[model samples]
Target: MNIPGPEPRSDGGVGAVAAAGGLHTYQLRLHAEYGPVVRFQLPGVETAVSVADPVLLEATAHIDKRPESLFAFLAPLFETGNLQVMPAGEHTPWRRLLLSVLAGRPSHERHFTQFTALATALADRWAERAGRQPVELQKDLTELSLRMICAYALGGDTADPGGIVAAFEEVLTEYLGRLYEVPDGGGREERTRRAEEALAHLRATVDRVVLAHHRGSHPDKSDLIGALVEAGERPARIRDTVMVAMLAAHHTTGVAVSWTLHLLGRHPEVAERVADELDRVLGDRPVPEYADLRRLTYLEMALKESMRLYPPGPYGARETTVALALGDYEIPAGATIFYPFWAVHMNPDYWPEPGTFMPERFTPEEAAKRPRLAYIPFGLGPRSCEGAALAMAEAQLVLAVLLKRFRFRPAPEHEVTPTERFVLWADDIRMTVSPRRTGEEAR
Candidate 1:
């Protein structure tokens, strides 16, 4: 059988699969047929695809090590000062500081209680809405994740976040749609314009919060903004970095939530198990504390399974600075190498039933048995998501709280199809949520 790559086959066909919108359906379809490395060269765009273990690791590390030019794609979405746009060397110190305060064990533990409370509050609101017909799961998940990020990252309230979140969502979804034309239509240039406009709105809000905090007149807060202001960085860069954190931190998790809900709706068994776990661990509590998260390992596995089948950041790309040999293709220095986590995660060689939703694949023992790079929902190298821990915590909290209170079934004829952008999202998931009876609720 012929493998998927840049090479033309004996059968007359378009060279490498270049669908209308750079959709790489063929890559996922034939990943097992192909070995580890597959390079596709389009006119003016040379891209390499990798599903092999060694190639994926080396490729990720190579980009993470020297990541200045490779981040240009982000310039249109975030200002140049954004951490995602910062050169590798300059970006390192800030990342270290962030990890120390945010992603590390200490901060994660400290914030767990807060997240649990937030989760319960949100789920309570969802319960209130359970009587109001079917809810759009994608919209609900997006709002929930965005609000949490804003509260945590900006240390703000819900009063005005809705509009800002909506604007950010517009720009994100549009950019994901590949609309990059400048001046005339909505495309890359248009996305940059919208992002800047949205940033201006957010900056005004940030300025108010920052100035108030700086006056030594506000109450102490431990949210993301508080963490940044206390970190003591240059004012301008600090503002830009906060914006970067907001964009980078929330979008992936938002998509993850959407995928999680879609998967649970499709697999009632998984939802039942998660709900059962939540009930067994905690009952009648207003909110679960940080300690409860450990008991939900299966929920973590379920999230991992959802991500494996549908990772938020489906594929990552990096432009090479030097020539590289991949498979039968000789890629030049300027080529853009594509590392598709979606394809890699779904390759049957690595995952027993690549297309199924089986959380067992992520059990500690099973995970240990798999290749490290093979599981990169948070990515593999230094450039891996900084907010991964936070995302996971928030996911567990929301899932546990929501499932404990309500049971959801897929809305009639609701289709869950992935629409790709910087993150992969179920186009629009709709679910019928019913409030569980007192006794029927997670016991």
Candidate 2:
């Protein structure tokens, strides 16, 4: 069967996607017009197949190769080649190694204090604002998550946490700003130079931690750098891992929290439920202990539902090594397979009232009735996010603190518009926060 899509244009599929406003909207429109399986041109790739059906996604799950054209921009962030686009054999070991430390209970527990302190510090600063000005959730939260990740990867002895975070911001500014356009005063060259310097500083900080591990001063079960070193990985690879970890953890987790809060502000009734749950679970504690995460069940459900609505990383891609039988169509070997996660999450077949914000959709019983791939905010298969557990822990902890102390209401003057960039973001998420004074006030 011929796959359905718009007629190919002289400019390829760029016009179609751009006219649709971005890939998220484009994929949603594509699937709606042409059904779940649509073959379309993706900017560079002459023809790519996007699979929006969760059941069909199962067959493509084993593919470990990511198409390079879409991921090439991320190459500069790595030293031992791009980890995300590495081959299946190399990626398998690397993913396993990262999961060992990243997904472990000990690792999350080990870093929970630093994480709490960072969240609290941000809350304190917001408290000082006294609701005089609306806070930019994306800006504040991403920086906080960056700090948490840096502290987690480098241990408490990091020389200058502020400088490290600023450096990473520089790197992101360059990479995300399209590398050619200068930010503020600098030319492209100057911006590139600053980003390179920042990347070098990040690598140097990781080297410092690696040296500490070699000296046996940092002995622990949750040491990422130590684990990599113990497994005889190369220095360049260790640096790349930390770099990627910082990049992946900070933005995605930060935006996940922001988008969740964005939704909660719109749906005050749901917000009250989450607040009530937090009140019952924490009992006047401003922050949650690591173990308290499980007890904050409704908060977790709200976060999950938020991610489903505005998934941090909206889509993923892979290169098919062999022919894939996707329902009525056959995807040939070496073709590009685009995973439109945003489309799947809103497929209507799986998610009832897909546009509505209802956190209870994630209650374990409700979720169990759906396909495993039906709700993948972290992605799927071997190349899926290794930091899913850690990201969830970080988002839930941050939300717990902020929601517990403050009640967020959308700034009436500002529109919280969701856009697709590297992550699902808004032009600005301006929300007013006033401290919650009482449990009854929460309800």
Candidate 3:
């Protein structure tokens, strides 16, 4: 059956996507006007099919391949290959290796003290600046997230944390900037030269860490580099995997926590409840132990709800390995399955009052009622993020530390507008931070 969409625009979809804001926003408009399965023009490619229905999403879950062309912009950062589009044969083992360490409770426990330190430091700095200025949540939190990933991926003892963070930022600014046409201080030729230099420095840093892992003879599944080394992955692939992890984990986790706090700022009642949970769980302790995460149930729900409202990575894409039946529709083989995460999240059928921020919707009782794909802050299926567990832990830890120490109020003059960039960026979330009094309520 022919899918419904707007007539092919001569401008190759640029004007349309721009008019609606971005790719995900355009997809939402499509699904709203043309129903769940709507075909639309993606700028670089021909027509793409976007499915916003959860049940339909289940049908395509088995498709493991990602369209490599769409992700080409990130290719310069990877050495071995784009793991995002690695063949199923290669990806399966690589994913297993990553998950073994990244998903492990032991790994989380091992790093908890260090992660807590990083978060506490950020919180302490914010406390000092609390009354002085509206803290830039997006900028400050993303940088913290980058540092946390560097520590997690390369270990805290690695050289020059600030330099590593700066290099990665430079690489991203040069590469991602080109895709979105975002201007930078340096000219294109100069930016490219610097980015290449930064990329080399990062790879060398990973190599140093890998060499240490090899020398220590601690190739354990509970450690990220150790697991890869133990699995006998090629040095290049190991570095590529680490790069990908840092790339995926940093901004995404940073924005997830930032958006959650932004929501709490607007919804003081819910923030009060989150604070109550923190109080009851930690009592007098300022930071949560690794075990305390599960007990921070309300806080977890709030984070999940915030993601539902503003997923860090708004959309995902997969290539059909074969012709597929999606509900009433038959999709052709080799078609691009557009996963409009924001639209699926906002689908009224699964999420009642979809636009509202209701953390209770994520309670076990309520969450059990929705389809698995109904809430995909992280993308779905086999090509889904391997760092999912770690990202959650990182976000929760950061949110706990900051929310415990300070109350975030949206700055009076700052506007928090949701625009899709890197992650579903907030342009910049500037919030007034106030040190929490010992017995302060959310007011």
Candidate 4:
């Protein structure tokens, strides 16, 4: 079956989708122009098929292998072998272990206090700067998310939080830069050298934490690293796990919260509703407890709706291990099947006024009317984000705490644009915050 797409250009087919701004924008255009299953060319992959229809997504949901070539940029960060290319048999056990640690309610409950405290601390800082300067939403939130993840994963030995965050950022920036750069570009050796240096710094940092834990100097079996150690994973494997978890946890949650706040900033009515919900749920309390999360129903809906409009991880891909039939098309084995989540979320058939920031779209009754796969901010299938529950909990708690304490309005002259850099990121989500008066607020 011939899938519809642009004719490939001679510059290694990069031009097939280059005209549409970034990859995420290109995908939106591809689906808008050529229906659901649009064939395109991606760097390193032969032929890519993007599926936007949620119903059609159900057909290829079970295939779990990622395109290894596409994820090769991450290979340098792992020492016990690349988790991205692990065979299905081995992948299952690894994924199960991750889910047990990351997806369990007990873990989330155990870490709730720490998460809220970190968020509250940041809010306090922002409170100090309340009329002083615009708060850098992505920068500050990413730091908060990093600190939270480190505390949860590595225990109390995270003495050098700045060092760890810097190292991780350096490593990620180096690799992502290479991944997005034109293939066969100049100065390849220098880029490789810098990436290796960053990788080494990250590995060394993880080694110190692991060694400290094992020696009983910083023993904490309740944390993520502790769980992995208890599960009898090797030191090298544990390092890989920690690095990968940090990589996944760091930006995605921060970006999600940032986007949600940006949306709330633009729509004061929605922000007022969120404040009302927070006011009703946590009447006299400053921060929310885990139980309070369930009561913030409207806040949850607004967060979900924000993600539907701007999913942190905009797209997901799986390479077919067998001949896959999606809709009326048969995708050959080894072909890359792209799940353009942004496109799916914007599909007009499922979401009316797909571009509108209407939080009611995610209310329980309205949500039940849509297909299960229609709003997969985390994704679908077995290899989906194992930290979905944890991420949502963290995001909601942070949003609740921040919104209740302060009012966020977008900076006067700042323009926020969504760009894909391994995740949906806006470099300049400049928003001003003002402390809400105790009685005057939430009215």
Which residue pairs does candidate 3 place in steric collision? Answer: none
Compose the digit string of candidate 2's lDDT tens values, residues 134-180: 99999999999898898888887687999999999999988888722
Global fold similarity of model 3 (TM-score): 0.97
Regions more than 4 Å wrong, model 3 = 183-186, 217-222, 440-443
Provide the clashing-pair count of each candidate structure. Answer: 5, 0, 0, 0
TM-scores, all models, native as reference:
0.84, 0.96, 0.97, 0.94
The per-residue C-alpha lDDT of model 4 at residue 254 equals: 89
- Give every collision pair in model 2: none
lDDT of 4 at 238: 88
Cα lDDT tens digits for candidate 1, 367-398 = 88777678777776666778888888887777
The Cα error of candidate 2 at residue 202, in Å, is 1.1
Give lDDT tens digits, candidate 3, residues 245-287: 8889879999999999999999999999999899899987899
Which run of 10 residues does model 3 get worst, by summed lDDT?
217-226
lDDT for position 281 in model 1: 80
Model 1 weakest lDDT span, ten residues long: 11-20
Q: Where is model 4 more than 4 Å wrong at Cα?
A: 182-198, 212-222, 440-443
Worst 10 residues of 2 by lDDT: 177-186
Please state the error at residue 374 of candidate 3 in Å: 0.5
- Which lDDT tens digits does candidate 4 get at residues 284-359? 7999999999999999999988999999999999999889888779899989999999999999999988999999
